[model samples]
Target: MITGIDHVQIAIPRGQEELARTFYGDLLGMSEIAKPAALRRRGGCWFRSGAAFLHLGVEEPFTAAAKAHPAFLVDDLDGLQSRLVEAGHECVRSDGEIEGVLRFHTYDVFGNRVEFQQLCELG
Candidate 1:
């Protein structure tokens, strides 16, 4: 039986940890978390923002994930949109058909689609 997601992983080219740190950490405000001792040698990074966790795994010949993405819940969609646009990253507003939420989509350094959403009370 399924309960909840533990974490989401995105494959990135090897030796690109710096870019991941800049995007997920500096830009998005996620804190970089240390990988376990055994996993440390593999070369990648993990990040945490509140309860959300994202793992950037090292993949040879990495291909960007175009359709599949992880949607993160946020408190202020407008503030995030401003932050992202000011940082020069394109944040495109999604044409929402989902009830009670405002959302947008953006790409990481490696072109992985990342979604941010804020829930609002439905009329």
Candidate 2:
């Protein structure tokens, strides 16, 4: 039986590791994890924060996932949003469809859609 997700993989154009590092590492605050030796030649990078892992794989003829994305649960949603904006990333606030969830979507350097959310505390 499937218990939980191990990691989420996103496709990126080849030779963009530095860009990934700057965005996912510097901007998003995720730590880079080394890929296995066998997988090193494949040209990609991995990152982890707490229990969440994201793998960015190099793809030829790459196409960004504009519609589909990974929604990350965050603690300081407003601060993150500000950081993204100051760094020139546009944060699109979500409509109140999920109820009690404050969220926003932004595109990465490669145009992959990403979502960040924070849950509201109930009184």
- Over all chains combined, what TM-score does candidate 2 have? 0.97
> Residues 1-123, candidate 2, lDDT per residue (tens digit)?
999999999999999999999999999999999999999999989999988899999989999999999999999999999999999999999847687898999999999999999998644
How much is the lDDT of residue 9 in candidate 1? 96
Which segments of candidate 1 are over 4 A away from where they belong? none
Instruction: Give the whole-model CA lDDT for all candidates, comma-separated.
Output: 0.91, 0.95
How do all models score by TM-score?
Answer: 0.95, 0.97
The collision pairs in model 2 are none
- Per-residue lDDT for 25 in model 2? 97
TM-score, prediction 1: 0.95
1-123, model 1: which lDDT tens digit per residue? 999888999888899999999889998999999999999899999999999999999988899898899899989999999999998889988746688889999988998999999998888
